[model samples]
Target: MLNMKSRYAMRALLYLAGRYGDGPVQIGEIADSQRIPRKFLTVILSELSREGIIGTKRGRAGGYWLEREPSAISYGDIVRITRGSLALVPCAARLAYEPCDNCVPESECHLRLVMLAVRDATADVLDRLTLADPLPGQVELQPERQAAPAQ
Candidate 1:
């Protein structure tokens, strides 16, 4: 349920991860290769740069690059930075918690408890995964696996 902004952030991060140690990648190249809007990427990159997750170099050959190692940057970190909280329900949010606007007492709300569990479970998976990890079911770029998989 992550919004387009968050998805784009991850996509951009992945693009950089793929080119780690290769030098900064221009924002234009990122937008073109990732199919993200250049204007939107400018805003997104600025935000990410402010967050210390990315760094920018200014000049004709300058661009953006990851500030931290790919292994150190988790999906949860990106989501939290862009989305604020992983909780589907505001009352269950750990980083941006706000009580429900109702008479129901927080301690007695079953729904709140379930939502908290959901938030934790979601965080567990995302926090453990990073851009360096290969995605499940993604085919390797090897000649041996070019053919179709077994039925």
Candidate 2:
């Protein structure tokens, strides 16, 4: 249940990653190519720049570029920046933890245990996915093969 802002941030980062080391890319071009509204991208880019995730240049060739190599930037980095928290529920959150209203003791709560497991799994997956990874289009979605019937 990723929010729209997080989705947009990822898209923008992916666009930059695909064009990394090519010099700065125009903000308008990024917006057009990614189908993100220019005004919104402006705000997101500004935030990213402030966070040191991206660098901006000024002048005729001025635009935006990644401050570090794409491989150095993980999905978790972007998610954390854009969404503020990776957990779906406040109780599951590590940085923004707030016990659920109904739960008296989060430490022993079965629901919290399940949610924490989910949060860890999700974080692990995202942390491993770097911006320098192959583009989505390059990934071949192989259909599942049918298994032979047991003898």
Candidate 3:
């Protein structure tokens, strides 16, 4: 499951993406528009700012904006920055792989195999999607219009 921090970060990024090249946006405006808590947004923005994903300014005209183009930023990138690894389990994590504390050796573990496939599928979708892409429910919710993967 996606954590709240990552979810909020995505929302904040989407909001910024919408306003890209416009100018800095005040924290209050973002919090109010996105319905994210003000205090939590401050922390999230600070973390993203440190990552150079977003730039900020101070004073009455100060706020935040994307440091890079929306198309340059992938949903997977945001999730990785906020959640560390995309894997639901440590053993299945490609970037941060670790054997589960009490599990069988990876070579013999079925659970790990399933998790690896899950992680790969998740990455496949998220990495292909950028902040500039219209999310599933944004333009319209059309599950039937989405094609299934080739066998």
> Which candidate comes out best when scored by lDDT?
3
The pairs that clash in candidate 1 are none
Model 1 / residue 27 / CA error / Å: 0.6
Angstrom error at residue 103, model 3: 1.4
Q: Per-residue lDDT of 13-45 in model 3, one digit per residue for the tens?
A: 999998999999999999999999999999999
Arrange candidates, best lDDT first: 3, 1, 2
Positional deviation of 38 in candidate 3, in angstroms? Answer: 1.2
**Candidate 2 lDDT over residue span 108-133, tens digit each:** 78888888899999999899989877
Per-model clash counts, in order, read 0, 0, 0
Q: Which stretches of candidate 2 lie over 4 Å from their true place?
A: 102-104, 135-151
TM-score of each: 0.88, 0.84, 0.88
Q: Please provide the root mean square deviation of candidate 1 (C-alpha atoms, Å).
A: 5.4
Better structure of 1 and 2 per TM-score: 1
Q: Please report how far candidate 1 places residue 39 from its true position, in Å.
A: 1.5
TM-score, candidate number 2 = 0.84
Off by over 4 Å in 1: 140-151
lDDT value, candidate 3, whole model: 0.94
